[model samples]
Target: MESRFLGIAELTDVPDVAVVVDVMRAYTVAAWAFARGAERVVLAESLEDALALKARRPDWLTLKDGPPAPGFDLVNSPALLRGTHLAGRTVVQKTTAGTVGALAVKDASLVLCASFVVAGATAGLLRERACERVTFVVTGGGGRAEEDLACAEYIARRAGGGAVDAGPYLRRADASRSAAELRQGVREGSTPEDVALCLEPDRFPFAMVAGAEDSLMVLRRVAPVDPPPSA
Candidate 1:
């Protein structure tokens, strides 16, 4: 197996498997939503697209970050999602980084979303598949997002047959500018719990996999046959 890391701009270069990382909040939020029992998540390129999808499917919930939008049902905060009941419901998600990066990968046989919370599981799934070529897409700021880049490297290392300690990578992610933004968001009414939640490596036992369905990118959880030993 061969694995490499790429930025959002290089998503088109993704090969057999594409792993999109957005550790600060986007992919973390998606993992939490799935953990909370969401049936599926639809990746939207923008808030307008999310709202349009919601309008077409009134029962689907729309989630996004930033200022409250007219049709959004929820904010893209894992802390907020923790209290909501999403069991058996479909979610339409739009974010500045994660969702866009996820939807941009056009030719991969498999697409996965990753964060510290699901890093080990994502890598485990890739190993199980015996993928020949894998690319980790750092979705935040076209790879300038340090947290996402660190998470991508961590996953790539693991997928490439390395049993490494996650401590250093987690520390790097915590010290990133995105982490600082998350802290600032907490002071502005977002929950502090999000900071802690986003940094918990391998918190989930399943990987989030995305499959193209018509015009939507649908994400579902897939547990690896053999989970990797704790990092």
Candidate 2:
């Protein structure tokens, strides 16, 4: 098995299995949504697309960052989502980094969304697949996306049969620019629980695997088969 790290710009170069990391909030919110019983998450390229999808499927919920869009259901904050009941419902999610990066990978046989919340389960899923080539797509662009990079490295190390500690990576994510932005969002009346929720490593036991349905990228939670024994 081989693992390579790439940025959002290299989405086209992803290999057999691609793990897209967005530790600040995107994938973290996704993980929480799934845990809250969301049926499926549709990846939208932009806010316009998300709103359009919602208009078409009136029952589907719309989730996006920043201010709420017209006809949108919720903002992209896991803390807010924690209180909502999403059972048996579909969600249309449009994020600047995570969903866009995930939808842009056209070649990979399998694409998984990653964050500290689901990192261990994601690495477990990769190890179970035993893929020949795996690429970690850091969706927050590269140099400035410390949280995403740290998550990629942690997943790679765990997928490679290494008994690595997640403490260092979590610390790195806590100090990232993305984390700072989330903190600022909290002060501005955004959910104060978001920063802590995003940084909580291994909060979920399943991986968010991306698949196509009707030409749309959809994410669903998948438990790793025969997960590695806990350290």
Candidate 3:
């Protein structure tokens, strides 16, 4: 049972478990939404797919990149979800690299989204499930970013039962090119506040599990518990 770290481009070789990380905003926001009481999250690879899902189920919350749409309740910014009531709600998340990486792991038996918010919990879940081969996929800024790589390293360490000093990695990530994208003018709908939220480590206490139920991909929270053995 060894856990390996990989980049977004090398997603062909899936492992027993694929842990996708998008620290800049996508997975961080998802973690926050779950902590705030979101029932389930649906990850969509494209904005069109999210829109189609939203059209069919008008009650589900849809989040994506760019400026806030007319009907969409929120964007991919973690700072915007504060104080919102998400209980009993389903959120459809469509991001550039995060959700796309998640959807690309066709060979993985289990898929989970990871961020600093849920790093420890994810590691615990993997141990509980006894997944021997795990791959930490850093979906870095559509190419490769320091933040995602740093997050992957931290997660790998935690999952391997090792104590990790994440300060240096987080500092590097804060100064990385991807962190700059969170600045107000760097990308549309991106805000400086998001950068602050994404860097906060261990902010949540649950791991996010992505599973297919009734042919629909869904994200659900995995609390700290002894999980059953891998299927």
lDDT of 1 by residue, 1-231 (tens): 676778877655546788988986888999989988899999987778888898899999998887566888888788888888889999999888888888878557899999999988998998899888888888887777888888888887887765779999989988987777777764332566778889999999999999988867899999998766655
Q: Which residue pairs does candidate 3 place in steric collision?
A: 1-132
Residue-wise lDDT of candidate 3 within 1-47, one digit each (tens)? Answer: 58777777876665778999899878998998897789999988678
TM-score-wise, the better of 1 and 3 is: 1
Per-residue accuracy of model 2 over 1-231 as CA lDDT, tens digit each: 687778877655547788988876789888888888899999998888888888889999998877765788878888888888999899999888888779777457999998988988998998998877888888885524889999888888888775788889889988887778777764332465788998887888999999888988999999997544334
Q: If the candidates were sorted by their lDDT against the true structure, best first, what order would they fall in? A: 1, 2, 3
Clashing pairs in 2: none
Q: Give the TM-score of candidate 3.
A: 0.91
- Each prediction's whole-model lDDT (CA): 0.84, 0.83, 0.80
> Model 3 misses residue 89 by how many Å?
0.1
Residue 145, model 2, lDDT: 89
Candidate 1: C-alpha lDDT? 0.84
Worst lDDT run of 10 residues, candidate 3, spans 222-231
Task: Please say which candidate is ahead in lDDT: 1 or 3.
Answer: 1
- Alpha-carbon runs more than 4 Å astray in model 1: 12-14, 186-189
Model 2 scores worst on lDDT over the 10 consecutive residues at 184-193
